[model samples]
Target chain A: MGSHAERKRRDGAQPSARVPSASPAAAHAHRESMPDGAAPAVPGLIRLQPSSVRAAAQTPLHLLPCEIQHNGPAAVSRFFSPAIRPGSSGPVVSFRGRSLHGEEVTLPSGYMGLVLREDKSEGPEDRTVQAIGTFSCFTLWGLEAPPGPNARMHRALSWPSLATAIHAPVAEEDD
Target chain B: MLSHKKRPAEVHCDQWVLVAPESVTDLPGKTENGPVFTRLHNPRTGEAALYLFDTNAQQLFEVKAFHEEFHSWFIGQTVQHDGRLLLVTPVDPLFMVLYYLIKAEKEQGKFQPLDQVVIDAEFPSCSMLLQCAKLRPFLHHVTEEKEIGNKKFYKYSKEKTLKWLNKKVGQTVRALKIGNVNVGARVSSATFVPGDHGSDVKEEDYICYAHGLISEYIPKELSADLAKYLKLPELSASLPEPPLKKRKVSDGPVEAEEDYTKFNRVDLKTKKTNSKMTAAQKALARVDKSGMRSISTFFGTKAKAGK
Candidate 1:
């Protein structure tokens, strides 16, 4: 009987082992004897460490496959060209912002673009968004939304049309 | 005595022409000076030349052009003409349009191009140059609208605001030099406070909370050590233990019932009916008694043979 009781205690002491008790009172007593925050003697509950929660939440999101090649303040300007406007002879797209010297530029066809400028804010709620630039009929190249906290900009461009135009296939398909 | 030496004709390209000034000058000539016009050519292709003219002779004459590889740093950006190096200035498109109009008038003999004009002599830094290029088009667009409104009255669209957030987020994360233990972990979700249905009242008066996640699993102790090394404050408090409960098991009736189950009925039958049985029969009966004893032992009970 002494050996049997000792075996029971040994089995119960394992980290992965679970003890079956007839009464809640006995189970409660058993749990009190365990070290603080240890796994519950009962079967259902799991005690996850706080660090695990933080670690799980910090996982990085997948990055989209796209590259931004240009640099300089006017690097974005390459995407802009003369856009056609009704009853307008020259380039139609006009940039209206504080920094501009007030000029009107026409974009060539097949050029489409957009620009967004956000002011620094103490919080996300206090941030201001300004449409600093835009063009007509541009393609979005990547995912619709930003990937993570690090993704400060989201840009997309049309793919199939651009690809087809750049790489001519042996047989042309009907548009 | 006349010397028989011929000077090289100044290199000129369509749209851009380079002319050496009689003297050095500053950039962006004034309306009074007859600035030296030069021919500028693209080193590559060498196809078209830009016609370069300056109105401010004093500024233009004072500056010298030197040959430097034209780094097409920004598109549609114009720089000052160094002897070979182009020093681009932040020219307002409106100013350019006005300057072009005045030049047209001079061509028609209605006015004279400036002979000697003063210009701002400071050369802009690279960043400043980039800023100028970025802001130029927007200013020109606003001017063309001819709207007489307050300069401070600006409206931001939802799309524009989100785009700004995206850029700022990227910039902040890239700028942060987190320690080695958290290298693969990145900022996952960032929330900004004072957000009104996705709009901000003021840019500066916002609070940003960024959460980062670990990509790989590490031992809990190691992870804790890393967090301690990085000096991250704990966000949650440890919980206290729950109270214990006691149970009372009765000893009288329960003990009697348990003993009754421990006895073997076969042993009682043999004791009552087999007083004169043969040795074989006794041995067989003993085997049956032993089987009952084993069953009782397996359940952690002492076996009782008779009633």
Candidate 2:
């Protein structure tokens, strides 16, 4: 996977659609034409668009137990919404002849979860993580019973906290 | 130097729900230094996943996604039918530095400056790890460093690395106690196998869980070594981890697209595989496969993609 494309980037420039090349504008050709220079593009960087970051808010989300293998529109209200029922332990949502148990999982403290949309005009090499929405918690659904601490995601949600300790700066006093 | 460039054949779009530190929002004015998200090889797995470098803060964070089937987001204006919840957390830069030092030991068998040793033609952004201020003080934990004329050259030391990993496991165990993590629950990921967790929790379970967590950052061989060093009794049989190796091949470092001509080509080739998909498959792909990252990443240890 790392063949010729490696060389293309090292050369400092490649013919790509993202470059403002269509205008045939020369480097520094128009300081008068534009006051601020285009942000120097960092190759392979995706940034959070500042304006979009401001738009982040609490968004409702669900994590289904089965893989959908798709990416576009869906009739969630018709097929999925009316199926959620309160069970003894937690919420149970039925779909495809299966009962899915749901539990709420929250992001670790000081971290915000945002639904990001790529600003379409930004090129692949350098793009921005434009936040369309945000969420603090989501329903994590699993088969049979809601996922306990042992569930893949339940354990995954514990990672950031564990990582903090594993990666924390070691105290100098340890012998 | 600004000359005309050619158009890329197609565009790449990524839309995932991301978790980031609050400070990342401060990135608008400072364009020069990025809160840049790039790809780096997962130190343990040698696979590439998206990593974020907030050079402005001189901090490094790793981004991983949590996805399950049939998940979707309901944002303010629309229903984002994607299945990924990306989590970004600060990662110790030393974990990555240790990767290079070990590789350097195998290749050159001698001391070399960090710049020379950490260079990767594929993941050029790996050099950005050097900007992490913690690298200098922490380098000695896993390497033997010699200073000459103000430049430090480093050689790998497994003994020290194991010692450092031991401390990591110890601290992770401590965090587990403080967090009151359900220590007796069955654990997944790392080299450890699934064992019954219904019994009472023991001190060893915490240690085992901690070691499994730390293993996510180091190589499997080194993980075996660390387990031995920690005197962790062999717990269970390790299974064939096919997804990580496959991920390594497909998810090349962020900069290392196999062929640029595929993007730079004048004439675009469009695959009509979508048209052939059954309606259910097509609709499902649209509703379910919204995560920009691969499904393999859903399991968090994809940081190691093992266990």
Candidate 3:
């Protein structure tokens, strides 16, 4: 009775394709350039891109200003919420934060990008929102912000004095 | 004449004009004792020479300075064109802006917004573009003005600037090109040779001090070691070991005293009648003070009693 026909049918179904997590270039290169002694290239093995190599190798964990605290065991949600939009100039992403009401509020600007994860298995909860960017513009490149201890502290960029140096007015789309 | 030949260290590595050494001395330029003024040319063509005269010593200094100033932007390889040298340095607009941003921040030791930095770096055009929000997509931290006294100033965050610069440099490097010269070649080509200043000097001296192939004399082993150093992981700063965290000693009782209060303070002088004796007494009690408990104890007799 426990081993029903439905379970058997599910078991017999074909497994889904193995999706690579790395960029297509990196993934393709990984397959082409396998080191003799290294293990078979898994999804997140060695990063070969110069920029990625620098990011992984040069930046020590301590130098990053992000605060990463243990947010208890993870929880799961049914839907996959996308954090970014592919716009004309670049990808735009909203910085998600909890207002005083504990409701999620999306900040309009001043954030680099968002990192969204598909909640496939109803496992643990995670910090799905990774808002990290430069003082200039993180949204342009759709880059993962440097790991931060907290999203709120890292997302803010106020330039009160910058007005003096600015010779031109901000151009609006409608104008 | 062979003895007059200079060592590789004395030879500059930038695009040389192949002039005789005397042309540098003959120029009616700045102070004679100081560095002689020379031309900065396109690394590829050596044809588009900038009239801006830079000091010869400064050129040598700038190469090292560039190594230090924009180490992140520098690719450290050169391409040769028609036997002249050109540095395949990053010429990206983003790179230039980032350089100015970092330079301004470092010099002022304060946060500088895009506008302020553009003015300080003399990139007024870039400043206008920034205000126009042309670079809006790339920027993350810019905000509205905060009025202080009569001045309206904007503060840029260091972390954001740094993050942006790092990403820009990386992206720029990926698409960087230097004419048709092969990537990773030993030396790059120069665009222009200095107009012969009617001096009896070699073109190499006219451009800058460091000469080509003349540096080949550098021991191969030393050069190889240097090459290894260039490839070795770059340390952003030679950070001295962080100063030891200062222990704040106040009028409060010592930490040991606090521990004593946490538990029952055992007095060693007290003759504990139970098994829970003070640690000092326990250790002392474990010692055979009688001395007779030594070898005599093994023999089942005291040393004095045995005698």
Question: What fnat does each of the candidate structures reach?
Answer: 0.00, 0.36, 0.00
Q: Report how far off residue B158 is in candidate 3 (Å).
A: 3.4
Index of the highest-lDDT prediction:
2
- Measured over the true interface residues after superposition, the C-alpha RMSD of each candidate is 42.1, 14.8, 33.9
Flag regions of model 3 displaced more than 4 Å.
Answer: A1-175, B1-4, B8-84, B88-90, B93-154, B162-166, B169-307
The best candidate by TM-score is 2
DockQ of each: 0.02, 0.18, 0.01
Candidate 3 local Cα displacement, residue A101, angstroms = 78
lDDT of candidate 3 at residue B89, scale 0 to 100: 11
Residue B11, candidate 1: alpha-carbon lDDT: 12
Model 1 misplaced stretches (Cα beyond 4 Å) = A1-64, A68-135, A143-151, A154-175, B1-118, B122-307
Which order, best to worst by lDDT? 2, 3, 1
Chain A TM-scores of each predicted structure, in the order given, are: 0.19, 0.68, 0.15
The weakest ten consecutive residues by lDDT in model 3 chain B span: B61-70
lDDT (10s digit) by residue, model 2, range B221-296: 9988977887777733221133333334543233222111121111212223323322212212222111122223
lDDT of each: 0.21, 0.58, 0.21
